[model samples]
Target chain A: MSKLSVIDNKRCVGCQSCMFACSRRDGNAGLSNSCIGVKSASGIEGDLTVVVCRACADPPCAKVCPTNALIPKKGGGVRLQKTKCIGCKLCQQTCVIDAVFWNKEENKPVICIQCGYCVGYCPHQVIKLLK
Target chain B: MNAFNDTLSRVLYIDVKNKKFWVTERKDLFDKYIGGAGVAIKLLQEECPSGADPLSPENPIIFAVGPLVGAFPLASKTVAMFKSPHTGDLGESHAGGRSAVAIRLAGYGAIVIKNASDMPIYVAIHGNKVFFRDATTLWGMGSSLTAARVMREREIGTGYRSIMRIGKAGENMVSYASVTVETYRHFGRLGLGAVFGSKKLKGIIISGKQTLQVTNKKTYKDLYDRIYKEAVNSQVMKKYHDIGTPINILNLNNLEALPTRNLKQATFEYAEKISGENIAQNYLGKRVACAHCPTACIHLANLREQYSDSPYFYKTTFVGYDFELLYALGSMLGIEKPEDIFMLIEEVEKFCMDAMSSGVVLAWATEMFEKKLITENETDGLNPEWNNTKTYIAMLSKIVNPPNAFYKAMAKGVSHAAEIYGGKEFALAFNKNEMPGYHTGPAAHLGFLIGARHSHLCNAGYSLDQSLLLTQDVAPETIIDKLIDEEAFRQILSSIVVCFFARGIYNLDLISQLLATMNINYNTDDLKRIGKEIHAEKYRFKCREGFSFDKLEIPGRLFETPEPTQKINKEFMRAALNYAKEKIKCQ
Candidate 1:
């Protein structure tokens, strides 16, 4: 089992390289489809907060899903079944961490599948892939 | 979402007076000049009328992001063009943060804000929607930080959003006011904030989630990886990420090139106290980066201040510092202590005033006070002296919120203040814009006179002063030629809108490859030609706005200070200016 983990949020410089990388995996640029997000903890001068799926053991988003579109992954997190989704955005509200991002064009939730693609782009080693 | 080609040429225009907005496809402009400074200058020409008052409604505020924005690392700069209230000519300032990315992803290659509002307002752009929110309550905020935070609360989209606002200095239309971006980064030079204030624009919040697609995905990935590797591993980038730009303090001080106390002397004796190493070791709170940039160059220092009423009660503040800030508020003001400099930094940030201009203005005021040219009556009972952090802090506020005639005049800028106060000889301003941190040599001074923006970054004359002139003697004509070529090439870089710090990583060859991946093809010569054309366009606008090469002021203070290179005189500068004039005329 594999999952993405925050090594230390304090080391984050708010570069958003992870966010850009996350979006780039689907052969595009910009933050529209990024499953991960980063923003200032306070103002830009303060610590940066990196928000991503924590890959819960028993994901509440999966349990609350009316269509069963979000399937709970083995170790943690959830996998999306595009055919089952109804574009309801219930998973976006159910997630405690607010890590479930929205694909506005498709009108669906974008969840990380624990690919760990962003780990290599974190210049400060703020995040890592746990296996 | 449209294709990248179509979306990249879209220009969004906003009229604050009529509360109307429109979008147009300007493929012609983008194709000819590229984007960022190039497209911005063209838009400025089309929008701003000739001989119009800079602080008047006729002047347009232009913000443009380049082709590389949102797609490349270090390509995070947004070019802001307006008629400078400070220079009364071409005003172009670049800021880093999420501004460039936000503007680009909002589906605009450029945004033009025209006319003025009758009342204070903040414009929020979320994708294609534009909201002219009444900012009556948010107006008159003490700090720009507070204004931005307030706007942040009212807005949506966190990671993709950028908030830009002005403080009291801008509200009062101080000639050297700056627009703070994301708290730490800023459109910091030539009074863009004054323009914002003139238009009654309190703040601007922009956010978008648009995605860009490139046809050749494999090539794009390879190019991105190469650039990323270079940015992460380069010696230059490492220095920027580690100690940041303040590391220049010690080096410049050693070379006796750092301007100290209104250029009365070239070197500061207490440079070590405010050195980058000392600050990074003692007070570095954290480092932050502009969106999409791998090198986090912006350094914030933790400044803890205990309330006077309660000794134990304290508030910790984060103040961003750079080479310019260190030179301006630290050495230039003779404030040696890091804490005092931090306090001064905070004061300038609160007022949203350009740190360099504020320091130099105060430095001139201090010298004038010493000379008895201006007394306490003029200073409102406050005596200003070198290294007096408390008085300087007080004066910073007064400059924003003027209590008397003297402070009001000072707010106009050093050139205007000196004209009124009889200190023109010592006034360290180039074409009405305050001198940057460099007093390197003739090249640095000449660059200020000739550069389109009258800024150090315009042509990096200080870099040339150190790299070429300091090592060996170079002819004035040769130096002028080199300066022009460098400045012209930089026009292309600014068009791409990449942070100038990554110029090494994105050379002409790499830029060609990067642009190719974006489906914009240009050979080295074609790129150079476009660069030259863009620079000439900016100069044409400057000329139309009453800029004259022969009439450019070479301040007497520049001669008083000793530079590392050869001593520069008025005769030398005049000859160089004449040569540059002839060369530019031919171009």
Candidate 2:
């Protein structure tokens, strides 16, 4: 199983450098299509919680998808087939970590591909890419 | 250019008196001036009447975000311009939070607020719709945090939304009042909050979720990646993310340039207790970043207090502590304990007062009290003593709601207060605005005296002072030139409205690349030229406002104090300020 590991998120500064890296990979400069989410544990005074697709063995997000749009990859994470997909936000609710980010501009659910582009951008080394 | 981000060329004008707002496409202004301070200065020229009182409705508050704000890393500052109640000249302050991103996403290059509301109100902007909500109840709130919470409940947007509010100090129109942005950041200088108070503008909440399209998609992404990598990997940027800005405390102290006891001494004996390293080691709760900024330089101190009523109960709070805060509240006030400094900072934050000015004013008061200039009668039966946190905490409430004439004088700021109270020698202010926490030498003091805003943030003259002492003895003429040149270049950065922390990252070449994405093309030389022009434009506003370099007074205390760069004499500072004046006159 291949997934991004949150080694120690207590060190997370909530800079969201990784979040920008997430969307910029797809030539976007916003969080609209980003799968990863880094929110303050409560306020900015607390630790930041890095939420991304943990590459669940039997992902709940895929099980809850109304259509077969969310196809599981051989390694992990879900791949979307945009043609058959309906804009039902049930997949967003299914994920316990709320890693299923919604693209408000285009009603689509963005899931992590685990390409690990964000891992390189994190100066704190809080997140690491493991295969 | 990308269709999504094209709306940045639009400017939103809000007339609070008429209770009407309109949007106009000002691509012409954006084309030449760019956005942020650049465009705001032009707007200030056209809108603000000359010789208008800072607290009058004629003074318009201009908030501008640059093109690269939401799209580029470290481009997280929003420049707020208004007539300063303190300086009575060009009032400009930059704050980093969700302000820049929120403004850019709200689809405007600039938001011009004009006129005054008859009643207290807060404006909430969501996309195009502007709601002027009655904020009479929120007005005169004890803590700015409480008002922000009320606004949060009333306002719809979250996460993307920014809540900028002023507290009781602002309500009372204290000259050094700051507008608290979010819970941690602020437009914390030159009396922006007092202007908000005058307009009866309790706060502003802005939010939007619009996606921007890049002009050269491939090149934009590639360049974006390059900067991103450099920001996350560079040693300079990493320092900010690590210990945050409190790191400057130790460095400044080591150089014997950290102003303590209101410039009576250069370095504090107990500086190590409240330095960035100590704060991070002992009290650092968390580090946070401004919107779109990769470096999380903002450090919040974790202050936990035990509740006396309930045994085994503790209430933990987060108070932001930077080098400025430390130098002002800690060393300057003689508050050695880190916890005590954080507590004082929390009080300062709650009152929404500029911490630098507050510290300097308090220090001046302490000196006056010691000299028998001000008695307890003037202090409302409260003693003004150094290193006493309790006295200071009580004094803040009085500053917010000044009861007697003396407290009222203090509320005006150090310059005006000293003018009336007869302590002009040790007032420690530059051009009416209280001096910041720097005592490097002549360059540092001269920069404050001659700077457009009378702020260290205008140009880091302390850096020049340090290098000169360590390296060579540069002439006052050369020093003045460096200061002006630095101020001019910084004008470009502030025009772009990027945080000064990313000075290295957003150099001319990179700024050019970033502007390319917004379809505003300019080379390095063009940026430098425009930067100089923008600097002059701000001076034009200052000169129109009846400000002259000759009117600048360098505090005698600064001359008496000896820093690592040696004793700063009046003649040396006057020579430098005169040279700057001559240069401005020539321009």
Candidate 3:
């Protein structure tokens, strides 16, 4: 069994603090390359949709990777090898939840590694580990 | 160091009296201040003449955004600084929208408008070009919403652009007038709108599209993802997104800290009607957001009302309500009906009035009536009653236009109005700015008096006082010392262009880490040094303008009211004032 970061929308305040934290973890000062996505629907923020990699047991993103850059991880998820990635963006299109974010600067897909560092910063208990 | 070429641009200098525009590049200032309120403060200090009238041409109004703006997500706020027509001191307001991004993308670090225009005009900035268009047609438009719509229609760019315009209240030089940006968001404090009106400037429209670059691509991507995830999933962000700031109403009311009936009481009798839970259920029509903001905390709701004159039974009006607005216009005025408060908020927004100040002023008027300060002749045969939304709306219009003697006096704000009508003892203002709804403890009142810019959040002294009381009873001197230190530290955060809401996130260690990424290395000690310097600079300006902390007028009513912490001692407050003055002078 593998643990994945799950979002509870009810606990989110939409401050975007997590976005900045994610960008900072990657050593960036801005939000252009963050893997997580938080966007409101029709400007009504009562229900915020937090999009992150679901880390499926048999991932569709890994299967679609032409160069095999996205390999199956030990924890029932997939990991991206930037060196092997062809920047084909097949994984981005294949993911239904739109969790695989494309790093335009690196010409590679940014998938959540399940490091769970983001879980600590969520003061509202919106982000939780799911086994 | 120049990872983003679009970050650095020429500063626009506009002289309204001469009707001339010029651009000057000052990279040194941007490098040091990091723009936003930091740069605006420096510009105000440089341009504004000492003892100059806040509404006079001599007073300079500065608008600035940070380097992270336009390039980063959630960095979408513009900071405006001017000599407040209300406070008659350092006036600062920050609003989130495309305003900051538009200005940054338009190739400018800041815009400084000096002097007054001969006639009504609007400044239009599209990319690198700037034009002062005749806005005589738009002058005295009565409603800010109508003016914004007209400007939006005439403007070259739609969406991704910011249109900041004033209304009839501003044109009429109402002391608490505000400047509305993006139609709903406003620089809603200390009469920035009146400052614009005094300059004979009706509005400012800015639009641009420019890309920004990062220092490291791989690391930037990783860091960006981390921040995005937290922003979306964090509890703090969720609270803002769910019911918005109105949630504070319930918490504050439960804590028995909600200011009611002009601070005559602490807790509002009708807290349930104005709580976030009730508002979210009854109203909360839409939750709009600023450009690049994922949180979407803005709640704009439509209030349905029946028209007595027409065949149509009901009409829906769009209004934005938060805890502060609700408390100020609703409970503070003894208003229980949510719909009535909504209508009052709409009228205040329409006139481009600062809801906080407007509500406080109205509450003062109602109190004046109770005290027999004015008879039927003064109120134009209409009683200034509590919770009367219709009368409140009608009075607000009169205040905007000044049809009678009462309206003219009221338009000048509570401090001035009280001065004329002999109600200075309970004017509900500290250094000319109306008190915010946080009569929780002495810390709140003390914080308002000593805090830079006279805002509650500057030191959040009230919250500190509550914490101290909860832990153990502490001496007033000890509390004052802690508050002064906290306020000094907060100055550094503001100088770095960081939002006060993220104080916990941007602590000393985190700030050092964030700054290291920008190649600006500074430890906690350096931050303290810079914070103190900035605080001194602001105080220097205030002192030069004939401000005296020792001479601060403490309202007598504050002594009568028992705060959450208990009755505030007059001698204790006087000692705190003395301590604050000594600290500033020594610095």
Best by DockQ: 1
Residues B395-460, model 1: lDDT tens digits? 999899899999999999999999999889999988888888888999988898898755434566
Candidate with more favorable, higher DockQ: 1 or 3: 1
Error of 3 at B42 (Å): 1.2
User: What tier of docking accuracy does candidate 2 attain?
Assistant: acceptable
lDDT tens digits, residues B457-570, model 3?
Answer: 345676776787545666766777788778777765665555555565556775555455444567877767767766777787777777788668888888887777774788
Candidate 2 stretches with Cα past 4 Å from truth are A1-9, A53-78, A83-100, A126-131, B1-5, B153-157, B308-311, B455-458, B469-471
Query: Sorted by lDDT, highest first, which candidate order results?
Result: 1, 2, 3
Q: Tell me the TM-score of chain B in each candidate.
A: 0.98, 0.97, 0.95
Ranking by DockQ: 1, 2, 3
Better of 1 and 3 by lDDT: 1
State each candidate's clash count: 1, 0, 33
Best by TM-score: 1
- State interface RMSD in Å for all models: 0.9, 2.2, 6.7
True contacts kept of each: 0.77, 0.51, 0.12
DockQ, all candidates in order:
0.81, 0.46, 0.09
lDDT of 2 by residue, B134-252 (tens): 99998877788888878877776555668899998888899999998878898987889999999999999998756667877799888877877787778868777788777888888
